[model samples]
Target: MTTRADGRKILVVGVGGLGRAVVEEALDRGAEVSVLVRDPDKLARSVDVRRLAAVTVGDGTDPATLDRAVAGVDVVVSGNGAHKRMAREIARAVKRNGVQKLIWPAGGTNAFADDGVTPAYKLHEGRFPGARDIYLAHQGCIDAIRQVGVNHVIWAPGRMTARGARSRDIEVKVDRSAGMYVSYEDAAWVIVEAAVTDAWDGHLVSAATQTGG
Candidate 1:
């Protein structure tokens, strides 16, 4: 893990809350960051313009739109949501453009089986019917990416709070635990790290705080 200021070209597709954090981290890491946003005025007012290399304003789900956003990009880290099929188009464009590195968000539930805690997940599942829907959509995105055979990383983080401390000493697991949780900022950092690292190619990594560290 060399967190260097290499100024690599990176495209982040969504400039909202979570996406904003990703864009900030990418800029903090000295990458040439571009964003695909639906509203440029909002983004310009919201984001630090000095760090933005370019902005493609459109719905990221469209193949042509994604193609334009990803053109000449080395790596693409997406914060797009379940509604717009952003993951699907990102995968397709990554394949089309011969860009190997792609990182997108998935759900912690889908990464782990019901192991009896489906009850708790189901509690939230009931409150929001779309919880399960969103998870399923992420699963579909995972399947699509795997089938497409692109170099990718899918991040699934457990129950999260806002920013805590930044530590690379985080837990990564394929199975869910009742005790597992992560900070939102830490999760975003993990996604950025895994996206840039050569060691995590084609791997799905879950983020959690280091226990008893």
Candidate 2:
């Protein structure tokens, strides 16, 4: 399809299910991919290490590590979970490296105001059981990225059904009518496709499946 990511250098952070998914999807799209993982062995179990053009073994939450990892890559994709500290660090590195775009998940479930920047979750702290921590972390990331003035995208996906769902038939949109449940495989594909295709550069997004879950 002659997507923008063809032969582009893309660096993906986080080595868990989502991180691995982004890596594989970027590869499937013909992007030369590199991964920054804390443990190459652990990553190897999830993805074929040889398929990666380079591997940086370190804590992605560390600025020094990320500073090196972001260098020379055309784009950066992060699926490192929603943690304030990690987000702050990654944002700093991404900003410092001058990477064109930073793509990550907002941990989902946040409804935005008409202004687009204000989230409804902030109005009430106790929206649900144990929601504060997660919402705060997601906001922390949004704040960090904004403070650093980096071009980025923060998306949210509802409940993940299959972390290993086959990587195809994925869709990214706002129609929650399809329901919130998502497959990690498809969710990962959304991030990679966005990065490679250079779409959704500075917005928050909600995800759905191609064929209703």
Which candidate gets the maximum TM-score versus the true structure? 2
Put down candidate 2 lDDT per residue, 107-158, tens digits, no spaces.
5545353455555444444655555666677777788778878888776776
| TM-score quality measure for candidate 1 | 0.80
Clashes in each model (backbone N, CA, C under 3 Å)?
0, 0
Pairs that clash in candidate 1: none
What are the models' TM-scores? 0.80, 0.83
Candidate 2 residue-wise lDDT at 113? 37
Worst 10 residues of 2 by lDDT: 171-180
For model 1, residues 116-180, the per-residue Cα lDDT tens digits are 34522354576667667767776788887777778888776656665644555766654342234
Provide the lDDT at 133 for model 1.
72
